[model samples]
Target chain A: MPAPKKFSRDQLASAALELADEKGLDALSMRALAARLGTGPMTLYNYVDGRDELESLVIEAVVRHAAYPPRPAADWREEVRTLAESYWTTIRRHPQVVPLIVARRTTDEPTLEFGERMLEALARSGRSGRELLVAFRLVVGFIIGFAQGEAGAQAFSPAGGTADEVIQRGRTLPAERYPRVVEIATASARGDRAEEFRAGLDLLVAGLSAGARPASA
Target chain B: MPAPKKFSRDQLASAALELADEKGLDALSMRALAARLGTGPMTLYNYVDGRDELESLVIEAVVRHAAYPPRPAADWREEVRTLAESYWTTIRRHPQVVPLIVARRTTDEPTLEFGERMLEALARSGRSGRELLVAFRLVVGFIIGFAQGEAGAQAFSPAGGTADEVIQRGRTLPAERYPRVVEIATASARGDRAEEFRAGLDLLVAGLSAGARPASA
Candidate 1:
């Protein structure tokens, strides 16, 4: 008989995740993962098909770490808020994975479970068919997009520093040219991020209220 | 006097953008860009500091191509939709740049111009200070995030194909477990993306209507 497998898929996934988390997604490859695992690349084929499956595994590993609420909230909005927050927290822990998650749609159990739960809550909002789908897309877009904004702000902004530093820079911009941007930036800098996220989430839920009609449509 | 410059900043920026657009962002470098320009890396350095500045220039090149509305809409909502659509059109042409735009905060003139116009429209919503800031973030988050979702769906989804194909896959998913996801997939497959984006945008605007308040403190 063939020798028993040495590593669990979870174990292989975690190793791959570590490689990506440290060196970035581009640094991940079967050869690299094998090197990290102290094995040859050929040995890895026994577990994964190639880079695509490897990426999915990495996403699965990262998502599996999220601690979802023990029970769904009775209110659909609240359920969305809870799930969104849980997802935000989870992604924050693995900021490097944001691009991968945003770029690829994985069929991984953990990722799908998150989507299923959020969709369940959205369905409860009394929207069905195309409306339900749009709502789902909106929320998903916000959750992932919001994460991108925050992560980008932290990683990319040359002015990315303490809120105080950011606010200070905002105050210094030429008022005539960027009046609104300056004002919003200064004020937003003073506000708590958690509060901002909550407010934004509330806006999405409120916008979907029964009476509101699509302005463009 | 130093030799006359052979390339304008715009020309250099275009060459770099083409490099990134044709190859992935990772393929862009001083050496490579210079080679494309039929010059040495030192000559290229005279125009740009390095990859960071090169990237900013590339973004500027792309954003400059976006033709903003000659005039802002009379209503704040309409203004937002117009600007959002214009920005969307420009970025969709360069889908590869989405990650760069998302990860880095650029102060390029065109990028800032886009932000300034959007902020001006948002300000007309009558939100001020912290409220205005939150509202701006909400809109910006949605705009960028929604784009990411669409781009990702097109580029990364294994089911990234015709609506009918996606719907067919949705139909085959185990209904008992992914009922809501399956439902959304089937219904959303038939809807127009433009309509979906508009509806999602409307949801955010309506959610921010005067009477609605935050559910969480």
Candidate 2:
């Protein structure tokens, strides 16, 4: 075999991410990543301490790409919208990364920085610390949850069915049997995923904003 | 061998639900379900159509248990909260069923009925059909998504490292490296899941209620 190649932590993480993207996260292993980097497994360890560290790095890299624009000093509404969209885009791009994103609890630098910026923006809107924290969790949790559902739809697309096909199936159901589902599914079929995300995000932000408003002086 | 007994579809679905409770949804299969009911796989066909049909039945059964109290004639807020909590309790009882719940389109009869009641409540509150439909979806989607996260915590309870263990690790992170995460994680450690769910649900319901109010007479 040719002399083993040198791999940096970044290189190992990037390779691991690519593997996860291609074959899903469960398929990723230290040996597979090392081989992808053209290094021995032991040599790969010189960079990442273990699977947890490798995972942490991959998540950090993913979040780095999903980072929100610098927090606006005013207009928390726009900031929240931008931040949510950034996260949705990232999850959509790396659909497989989402389960990993949710499963791990990270103390990574970039994710923490992102959290701080979001908290600061919410604080600037004049909410109490507890409210700001709860709002922050709601926004992030909603985006993550919505993205997971969207990803599930993408992953579980039936062999012969599109969203339209499924909606059409609902429409043909006996009216007496499913009047409301048929009605809602018909309307929801025409509902674009992007539009749905925006609508939900707006609803959430509006609630938080209203809650933050000061009582009569 | 004892003569194979005839099995009804309800028996098969009941057995499958039991299997789900015992080993999770992933462990369920036609053979295991048939074995549990003391019948051959072929006999199962007499009651349910296939795996997909059986899954539909299991979901319907679980959802039936989630039914809300009949909608009071015009109180939309109470109606919505009751509906949300009912589904929440269903998910809590059958955590393994969530992926199936989220993936399948609403096709069961009881699920359809539940949708009708929710729509009627929203319609009475004066929102357009489109707004009511969107709000219904947002609520269901949020609950399903939140349950997935909560269920994951239960399913993957940190072996040797509970949330408490993880929080302790958070404390060790340099304040400069992870100020907000450390702060947030510290606070979250003291948080209760039921309280968190109630807060989120209330926020969502309050927001939708505000949006649905008629603008001027």
Candidate 3:
């Protein structure tokens, strides 16, 4: 009975992103998004065809807003690291969208644009052909994978403490059976997600630096 | 009605895994698993507590049977590679379970046992404390993350071909806008997934080797 809301495509996506962020990805449906927008499911169709379109909209909104540096750094490594950190910070804020982003392949303008910048940074390292593709994928994989790894660690931290806490409780396990686990857990009771993420990123960057030579020194 | 079918714990897990393998993870439910087993939902309760147990069972079954080398390789890098490949091959077979395994946290005996071996291999590199933990997590993350990336590529490959097909399609984009993407797509139309996977793994191993030093060496 009320007047229908006139929402732009970005507005629709922003609302959908908000829903997924607050309630988790599963809760983002046509009806739910419409209700959030103060509209009806039928009205929702005026924008998106269905779940696929809704998902794409949310994905684009997330990737588009990533705070890429104003320009690429002179050093390819720094460029890759800066761009990667930008992506990590963006996706980390919306944990619910992590799995969705990982699983759903999108050719949306925002994602493609991000990829172009990323590949451009890697190419600066003198990587060509498959090596370049592999490096690019490696960086992308690490960003998403590390996030998933952190999530898994949190899930395993039954007491809702740091991952080391999981290892701490795990210390009760017979040491003979899990010597390395106990040792690491005892030594690593302190945990920092960001530090750990950076450490892994450093390993990849260091490896890329060592393995692939620049076209000319 | 026919009498209820008798199944062991492993049998129950196997059937659930099969259901997930055939019908995707969403198809894995108490009722669906029960139906797969020629039983009723109530009967499934006798085996698994519910969805969580069912998921745990599937993950364990997949991880338990990984073809880990009989003894740790002489070189720590080789040891890590062997274990990671074992995990990669095992999980790659059951593509549906990749996300489930990545997302779910578990301390079941088999999963713990696998972790113990992995950490042991990593510890051999003299990466103690948090460094060891990060390295272990990096390998785990790479395995899962790389698989997710491959799946993403496949999903985006709308023509039902290799990931290059997706790139081929994108070649139509204005060259100036997607110069790097188009260049990579043009030079690298030949896709080899395993080769690409190994290439990424090589980067990680190379990174691990360069970053960590043995206490003795």
Candidate 4:
């Protein structure tokens, strides 16, 4: 009899990703993944070394989905904004995968493409050496962190009730104790996530522009 | 014989946190946690509802540990910087648990205290209403995102042989394909974490000040 056909790495990773999206990351165990693929748990190792590699594949696939029109040869600020927004969009789609992206160590071709494009944009900005990289990281950090918070609160924000009632309850927060928090967080939670992201993005770009601009610019 | 005594919720949460920190978040299952506590899994439920409540306790304790000296009555910029730094420190110590903090729906008392203090500081900056919250979220997003990147790179940055050799490998990239990234990401990987954070923080404060900041200051 012919040897049993095996799943490709991408196929396995895709299935795993689907499993994660459908069930949850906790449910994506080896046996569960094998069952999703119609294979034996022991046989699944033929494609993947184990869970760690599996997660890396999922992150790579997820990152690939976050598409942006390449302003790569254009202005540095716009390029950075586009890249950050794309990444932010990815986080919004697969919020569960944010931690996995942050946790995985390996860099695949697709993920590296995003980095390559981003770095090229930063280069056009006149930032070089450590500054360019630091800028890249700083922008990315803000985007991911903000997106995670947004995703985390989703189950509660719109999940709990309408924004008006939510704001009303939040507004009633004790003024004497957490005056700043009562007003700020309550109001903050009320605003739009995309608007906040764009506004913040503008600030970073402006600040970064001022900090790194060469004589020519 | 007398009835079996029970563990306190805090004690069980603490144990769960320890298990998560020691092994990994995935290892902190109900069965495993009960095993760690030297009690039956069913018995473990007496102190906690189940895995969900256990995770909450762990997140609460993790937030509590990310404490600062509380410059609550201090400068707005300084307060934002302090709170971000403390949160960063916590992520560093317990990188594994960052997801739990983000994933948890309800904000516990300790986490709110940090927020209360941060908002108070943001308020002192003459930003209020929604602007105050947007500012708060932006700063936080940057901090958390940066910390996640830092934590993610740990298994490689200091994990690989030496920084010099790693940079040498990084520098080997073709001068034409990615001169900017080669120079930047390579050098960024070499800088101290705190320095990068502070530098990024300054850029953000400057940008934010240039934006929503009041003219009086």
Q: What's the TM-score of every candidate structure? A: 0.83, 0.73, 0.87, 0.81
**Root-mean-square deviation of each candidate, in angstroms?**
4.7, 5.4, 3.8, 4.5
lDDT of 2 by residue, B1-217 (tens): 9666576666667788889988977688888887887778777887777777778778777887876665354467777777777777886788677656655555566776777777766666676545656676677666766665455422221231444566566556677765655565566567776777777777776777667677412
For the second chain, the TM-scores of the candidates in order are 0.81, 0.80, 0.83, 0.81
The C-alpha lDDT values of all candidates are 0.74, 0.67, 0.76, 0.69
Off by over 4 Å in 1: A19-36, A40-46, A153-172, A211-217, B19-43, B153-172, B211-217
Q: Report clash pairs, candidate 4.
A: A129-B184, A142-B142
Count backbone clashes in candidate 2: 0
lDDT of 1 by residue, B92-177 (tens): 67867776766555666677788889877776776677777777667777777766655553322343543345456666678899
Please write out the lDDT profile of model 3 over residues A1-217, one tens digit for every residue. 9567598898999999999988877799898988888887998788777777788889888888887878888888888888888888887778777767766667788778888999988887778778887887788778877766544433443233344556567667778988877775565456677888888889888878876765712
Candidate 4, residues A1-217, lDDT tens digits: the string is 9687677888987888898887767888999999888878988887777776777778777877878784463566777888888778775787566555544443465665677788777666676766676777777777766765565532222233333454455567677876776776576657777888888788888778767767413
Global lDDT of model 2: 0.67
| Residue B200 in model 1: lDDT | 80
Q: Which tens-of-lDDT digit does each residue in A128-211 have in candidate 1?
A: 777877787778777776666555533223444433455566677778998877887677667787787787787777776542
Best by DockQ: 3
Q: Model 1 - which docking category?
A: medium
Q: Which candidate leads in lDDT?
A: 3
Ranked candidates, highest TM-score first: 3, 1, 4, 2
lDDT value, candidate 1, whole model: 0.74
TM-score of 4: 0.81
